[model samples]
Target chain A: MKRYFWLASYPKSGNTWLRLFLESLSHEGATPDINAMAFSGGHAAVRDEFERLLDIESNDLTDEEITRARPRMYELEAQAANAPLLRKVHDAWELTPAGEPLFPIELTLGAIYLVRDPRDVAVSLAHHMRQSLDQAIERMSNPQAMMSMSKRFIPKQLPQRLTSWSGHVESWLEAPVGRLLLKYEDMLSDPEAHFGAAVRFLGIDADRDKIAAAVEAVAFERLRSEEKARGFVETPPGVEGFFRRGIAGGWRESLTPAQVTRIETDHAAVMRSLNYL
Target chain B: MQGDLTLCGWRVRSALALPDLLPWLGGDSPVDIDISFGAIPTPAEPPLYTLPHSTLWADGRFLLHLEQVGKFWVEKGRRIVLEPAEHADESELRTFLLGSVLGVLCHQRGLLPIHASAVRINGRAILIAGNSGVGKSTLAAALGARGHALVADDITAFDTPTAMLLPAFPMRKLSLDVLDRLALPHQGLIANRPGQPKFHVPAADGFAPAPLPPSAIYILHTDRLLKSCAIDRAAPAMAMALLDRMIYRRAVGMKIQPPPALFLGLSKLARIAPVYRLRRAEDPSLHRLDALAEQVEAHAAVTRPLLAGSGTE
Candidate 1:
């Protein structure tokens, strides 16, 4: 049986970058083809997928009803899976309405949770959500933050309930299960060390040279060019670009001190523990 | 089994005298299907398709189990054996009966059912297709509000004989939020199912009982980037692909993996009727909908005569 793992993170964190790195290893090329990444056609919350698997209309289902059937959906995906699958997930590590973990441990082999500097995250999220820096910071600060909740039509994935960033990080960290955390800053500072560590943690035995090539292949410039040449599927309807500037601490130039202070204050403990400070 | 009825171009006999289906009563033609309020007899053959809640095997037999609600056995594309859970509400059983059970039955009979809402335009069928909750029913309701006859809601089946779309239930399912936005009354309507925000609005004002010949298929999409509505026609090749996607529960249908007849049927439909991509504004309202319906009407006025002259049928 093929094992399932989660490429899990809070949105705009290094989730996509990490996936590209993994795809580079899979493709074993000079540069990872941005379009050639092997995930399901999309992330974990696809409505059409749920309905297709369960043979029920997901839109007709209440949010709680979708949540109730979510674990079963994962199981079915595992059953139907032919290869080792790494499904992308943005939802906080949480439980379904039935009190089962939304992403069940029984179905999962492990997860790679990517955490980024909350300060830089504020700047990127502002652009991704099309909100002011202050508004994005406020949204991130709030424990009840969510995406695609105010949608006018059926969202592709089910509504992802992300309690605040602190809660999101802690939920995964606090859970005693197969989870490996990778700081985005670490990947930037030492791509070879961190990326290879992640690959080994996920239990893939690859040549060190090949792993180094995978890291080199997913450079920020190459990803942005690919998004420019062909639009990204995950790009929201009006977002200018999904592959925004992939620099850390660019937040210093963009975020007002007050905005930085707010994120720091909101997530101070997690920052210090994750060594973001 | 009791008195049988015909709706959505299928004859159905059921044990329950469902009030929702009362309006669609009195079809004495040869029984195309049956519904019994009891346990189903074992199929003479082993299950061809094994699933968690349902089992389908041997020439269109399906035993569907709706968790905590009901268990249904759709047999040989001709009979439905229903056993509702003790204390299962009317709303629960009917939701599956009208949606998936009937849809799979149609698929079993080698019919192509599209996930769309439809209305009669210029005395012909104009389909509004989209993913679930893409405002298919809302657009169909808005069109119906403009006095266009509502032909089908949710599942619109194709009749190969006439090369026309067969109308489904004479009701449009609208979310309560939309009903509030439109200021439509909800005094006597029933919620489609328990705990669901949507209600089944009976098509009392403008409902079409008979099947109408094909005219056009409008695939609906909402673009946040687009400031206004844009309707673009799909070329023939693209239209065929779109029709394949428009199949109701397409992934589930793949399990049965209908024969080439399904593709031939859908491709034939695509070749004759024009398919359009209608992208609308992010925030939809009655005014925007009025503009959209007008654009579609104007487009149809030009194309209907062209379609009639083609003589492909």
Candidate 2:
């Protein structure tokens, strides 16, 4: 009984959206806030849980320190080893500390790769990060900073972020994992079709009408409204804004003309390939 | 013409022409050495060595291919290639190649090459075996600091005559954390690659040329600390199972082959080796060298008379 299902994606590439969709689809009456459960987003509740699990004073540790601390974190999280453990990870497909491949090419049952137009990702990231479009563009150029920033509160680092995105998606697609590549635009346009495809890939008997309703229930407006009305629970410090403007192409109006041109110039190849340009 | 030499129990073969050695070196040799030998000639360049594989080396002979990229040594195959470059300071290149090549050859010969650290206590070999990052090197260093001589770390080559075991090499590789914990100077840490540090610790005094009659083999586990230092004897079947886990499975390649008969012989040898699963706390202070040495010495004393009587019969 293989129970672990890795929910992997590059940062801010619609992984949270997928999680919310999954949360809604997996349970009908259970209104567990998807934002609170997402590992990537700045949800106060999940941040506290991650910090306690890692036993770190803060998330400001260096990459080397984080790598050393990860094994202990995994051990602590071992109790959550219930069947179909929907694990969220940002690491590239590689062997674990024990020398066993984490997702062996032979046994990878299912994976979902969410890719967004790099332009929109850059745009949305700049607004969410509270940084200028130019600063975000520069951050994306430096891979080390990008990687370090991913562990922190801000998502300003672009190169490391995008590289991770490309690497994670490519690894699963190439591996024997039954991978489904769903674009952010496609999901926003037709959540039911894409979510259903993801469900079928997982070998689940999901009904279309119910899944569509769940998707609607977990829409960006619904989550935003919930965040606004509830005053955002202070579950974890250093991680706030459990829900921001969860809209696609939000970067268009937010980024200046020069900023847009710079991002397009910087990640043009990737954006063009994904048809974002 | 000049090459590094080390004394071992096995016989050494003749050195062939550099050109002729190219194909034998194959992909395992250092890239610089491979190019210098011109084994795989560039489109514009002519081939330097073209001797047939049969004319160069005999089958079953131990050939050492030391590649330049990592200064690695490949042993126990028909062909050997050495790469060029002079970055001999990096310990990982040296250890990785030496272990990988020797591991493949040992597998072919039916001897198991364990990813372990061994030491000589009371003139008997006590092996500390475990998976990578399991503190084998750290434990070995602790034992070494306490006056026990180091045998090998990361890779241990085993040679058995009939059923008695003998030590092959005596060196240990320590990670940065272990080195820091031991308060050892930073001089031994070699930067072979970016962000990866490999520490080389020399054998202790009176430890050279010290091959011990095997007394015990312990598989070390660092995950959970044991209440006390306990030695649990392993059954023949269980010993073989443990040995199989340590065997370098990657050297076998992709093809399916019959299980080696050497495993059966090894299982019998394991029974004689006094196999034990040593579980200890993650204590950096509890150097078990002297205590373990005493235990092996006692076991040897009891087994010696029986071994002699059986030989006489």
Tens-digit per-residue lDDT, A54-160, candidate 2: 32222222234334444444444544544444655445554444555544433345667777766666665555566666666665554334343321111211112
Model 2 segments beyond 4 Å from truth? Answer: A1-6, A9-89, A92-110, A113-142, A145-199, A204-277, B1-4, B11-79, B85-93, B108-110, B192-195, B204-208, B224-236, B249-258, B278-313
Scored by CA lDDT, what does every candidate get?
0.77, 0.50
Give model 1's docking category.
acceptable
Q: Per-residue lDDT of B10-73 in model 1, one digit per residue for the tens?
A: 6766776655452435444676667777776787778777755667776666777766677877
Best TM-score among the predictions, by candidate number: 1
Query: For every candidate, what is the interface RMSD in angstroms?
Result: 3.9, 17.1
Candidate 1: residue B171 lDDT (0-100): 68
Worst 10 residues of 1 chain A by lDDT: A148-157
| Pairs of residues at least 3 apart in sequence or in different chains that clash in candidate 1 | A45-A157, B34-B80
TM-score of chain B of 2: 0.65
Worst 10 residues of 2 chain B by lDDT: B49-58
